[model samples]
Target: MKNSKGGIYKRFVKRPMDFILSLIAIIVLSPIFLIVALLVRTKLGSPVLFKQKRPGLNEEIFMMYKFRTMTDERDENGNLLPDSVRLTRFGKLLRSTSLDELPELLNIIKGDMSIVGPRPQLVRDMVFMNQKQRERHTVLPGLTGWAQVNGRNCVTWEEKLSYDIKYLSNITFLEDWKIIFMTVAKVFKRDGISTEGMDTAEDFGDYLLRIGQIDNRTYIKGLEKSKKIAN
Candidate 1:
């Protein structure tokens, strides 16, 4: 039997609430958005917004947006430089303050995301997800989520996925609000902005391979499949 509380909120209330709250946030935070956009343009050059396809509900693909935080520098071979090299001090400030994620308000308004749920991950990373971990996609992705508030980029992939699954199993107004408050606290404290020595969380595929959870052949196959889907 379904929990009436969870079913009612999930099926009827959540989406409408997300839409209204996101709309209100975008309006209320418009000034902050403008300031951040200006900074990104001046500091990072043209194309102030960074866009990438990520896995959303049921692993569906959608373009996720963020303030541009890196440069377009490349190497002698014309290959793009590493994240640490491209990320500027200004970009770090935006990330630490969580201002870079403001543009996701548009995604929420478009119904491509929720304000609270598992944060959408890279489409390529989805190939590394186990069946259970894949359950994180049962609902719309979020700008801030259970795992994000708990540890953000500081936690291991396993721990992060577990937090996401826990959130999925327990959906309610109170839980959602709690996560939101926690996210705000975390941002203010600037806790877990990134793992030590990493500009962002390590790629899921690399983690799986490092831990011997997936053989080289499997990893290669997953990468190829992910690229095909991405393209």
Candidate 2:
């Protein structure tokens, strides 16, 4: 009827719903959470949780948490190895099974996220978004979302952002529950865990540069903004 964001469910119901569901999930899944934490520590070492600053609602920066999925192994030069190098079999298992994202329930409980919305991206990734694409940040980020269910790491950056924008326009209560169900199916299927031949999805700026959709100077400027936000 209006900008769709004015919908009653989004304005009044979503956050409380997220809070209740996430709290229940944390309680019911406590055993799984503890086991995952211990396994991450035993496999990836200390700091069993992986935390990073992500752009959330209204582009606010908040630390998002996940279980550690990679090692801190550095090289002779004292620089960390590549993700492909540091990510082990166990890490791959966690990623593929989506077990590494368990800690994000805390983010939902803290109201830093929703159970459904655009999945938050790294600040570096957010910097590369144009004004229109950035509208995805108008709502709290989510653990799983339309883009996530549709193609996950399988889709192109453009496609995923399009899905995020599309989701904002369709934020009904039924729509969110539908997405949640679809997400469960996708996770169990472990579909689109990563694009073929890639350890992780390509970063937005890198994708833009590779496809010549953005100039080197523009990407460099985005990098400057990303660095500024991270600090």
Candidate 3:
């Protein structure tokens, strides 16, 4: 299982630790969860929890949950409006505070994620990654990761993937706790919540296109692959 790369801690202890910690977190955070759920439902209309398919350990797909932060407002053509139009002030508050991520504790308990690892990304994002870059999938995805604490939505796609690789190269108990501590600090500082002046974080494919790293043909292919995987 390549888990030996992380030594005994990653091989034998990580999952159990994730389970225990997540369960405790869920219990302790239950009231906050309920409050957030009610707020999201009342403010966002319905589906208080946002669910999306994300690539996890070994490139496996799983449904990651978060509090809904955008309205489903669409244009006259029935197309969804741009994120800038749908993201409300309340939504931004949820994101900035990281309350939107509270639901992911359930994912950690469910074994689809861990407390610290590479962040799970969109299927469209994974389609753009090469095999070596995708090696981040050798370990489970996390609610908060090395890349997130470093620059999060502020960093370029290439830099984010590099951070993920750097993290997986050495997975230890101390490293995980360090990430957790850094994450707490980052959250309080409200750093890197979104790309400056952007309503939402750019997707990997969109970032590549903006930088001219992939042509229209390759972009279209990736979009198709992402759709296929989602289906």
Which stretch of 10 consecutive residues in model 1 shows the poorest summed lDDT?
A: 1-10
Q: Quantify all predictions' global Cα lDDT against the true fold.
A: 0.90, 0.91, 0.92
Structural similarity to truth (TM-score) of each candidate: 0.95, 0.96, 0.97
- Model 3 regions more than 4 Å off: 1-4
lDDT of 3 by residue, 113-152 (tens): 9999999999999999988888888899999999999999
**Candidate 1 residue runs with Cα over 4 Å from true position:** 1-6
Please give the lDDT score for candidate 2.
Answer: 0.91
Measured with C-alpha atoms, the lDDT of residue 134 in candidate 1 is 92
Each candidate's clash count: 0, 0, 0
TM-score, cand. 1 vs. native:
0.95
Candidate 1 positional error at 2, Å: 16
Worst 10 residues of 3 by lDDT: 1-10
Cα error of candidate 2 at position 133, Å: 0.1
Question: Global lDDT for candidate 3?
Answer: 0.92
Better of 1 and 2 by TM-score: 2
Assess candidate 3 and give its TM-score to the true structure: 0.97
